[model samples]
Target: MSDKKNENGISRREFLTKGALGSFLVAMGGATVGGFALPKPTVSPGPSRRYKLGDPGKFPVGTAMKMDKENIFLFRDVEGFYAITAVCTHLGCIVVRVDDGFACPCHGSRFAPDGHVVEGPAPRGLLWLEVSRTPDGGVMVDADVEVDLGTKLVV
Candidate 1:
């Protein structure tokens, strides 16, 4: 056991190891413990759970969809690919998708279709939720990440 006191003479909070563990989470490959805000899906993922919101058909090319319902934004560019995420690089406000791109309603931070920071009170871009197409052809996004700034999804 180890005890390190803070400047207040109170025991400091335990520090969980950080680093590579933040890059990629083993998708549904391990049992997650508690003490997290956005816990696991309340129900088992079924056909309906494939997409957090309604059908992908609702989103067409060049349309930006805000899943504020899920604290995420889904942007469909002319390329037919969509981007999704919640973690804001600024003060962590869930951004809303607008005409050309995304803008944080919190502090007026704007982002492009590819998650590039166009304007700020925000220091950088939002976190990208690595998404894939399910067997049903719906998008599956993972939002368990905590980003300060400069987060991107390569896939």
Candidate 2:
């Protein structure tokens, strides 16, 4: 009984084969659905990015300074430090800076000043980017997210 033509129209053997094949395809950058085709990945700026965190003076107290359209918050905490992110866990909707920390304009998800998920829809915190200052006074940051960040990331 490793294989059988089930009443669901998909053979048991075929189901296993497709399941394995689909997983492999998905791992290979091609999502293989049972009845649908895999869409091609568009040419994009490769997954490497390094953004400067600027200076602490750039962002004053209370007000959240906007970085990008998605990254629109940088609250100055008691440590004279700041947080940054553009990812929204709830349906991946980009969060915006509200009177508090950040808010997902799409579905009303909210976050604390420390990137903590203050409201539902978003179940996680923002990314705490490890940054540094270069000799030129401009900051040099390594933002490659797919790799481990607990260790020092060389720019």
Candidate 3:
């Protein structure tokens, strides 16, 4: 037997070096690619809560305004001040104000200004939220509470 008589006529040193290099390359590739295979963890939102919606004086009487951050529409009609959820009753999508009333972009759900369902698809009217004036000189919108559509905050 002779060293030159090794398998495929390759020396043991060359065989071992090539094997080690291939193993190292595979290990590096796995280390870099395997991390993204698992899905990332997500944090769920907390319970529905109330939030301050700013001063009531900001809105002029007889006008309706949308508070995008609060997801509510502040209305100050001749009757009184009230708040309606901007979230559509049909599919929880935010509704936008149209010439007649609110329109849901996710679906063709239409609601009257008073939140009454005016067209098909939407099963019910928009939600009326509890609105109140805080002693801290701000308007508070209680998301956890649902009030009647006729309810108003006489701010």
lDDT of 3 by residue, 27-134 (tens): 999977777655544554686568776777677788787887878887887766888999988889999999998899998899887899999698889999998888
lDDT of 2 by residue, 13-107 (tens): 89988999998878766433533453434565575566665554564555446566335334454444334665676777777767777778787
Relative to the true structure, how large is the alpha-carbon lDDT of every model?
A: 0.60, 0.59, 0.83
Question: Candidate 1: where is the Cα deviation over 4 Å?
Answer: 1-58, 98-100, 145-155
Scored by lDDT, model 1 comes in at 0.60
The pairs that clash in candidate 3 are none
The candidate 1 region of ten consecutive residues with least summed lDDT is 146-155
Q: Per-residue lDDT of 1-155 in model 1, one digit per residue for the tens?
A: 34676766555334333333443464323434343435756777644323443455666666666666566666665555454575568898877767777778888889886677899877766666645556665656555543333343222
**Candidate 3, RMSD to the unseen true structure:** 9.8
User: Root-mean-square deviation of each candidate, in angstroms?
Assistant: 15.5, 10.1, 9.8
- After superposition, candidate 3 runs with Cα above 4 Å error: 1-48
Best candidate, lDDT? 3
Tell me model 2's lDDT, rounded to 2 decimals.
0.59
Q: Candidate 3: TM-score?
A: 0.65
**What local lDDT does model 1 show for residue 25?**
61
Local lDDT at 123 for model 3: 85
Q: Judged by TM-score relative to the true structure, which candidate is superior, 2 or 3?
A: 3
Superposed model 2: Cα runs more than 4 Å off:
1-47, 53-63, 69-72, 75-78, 145-155
Clashing pairs in 2: none
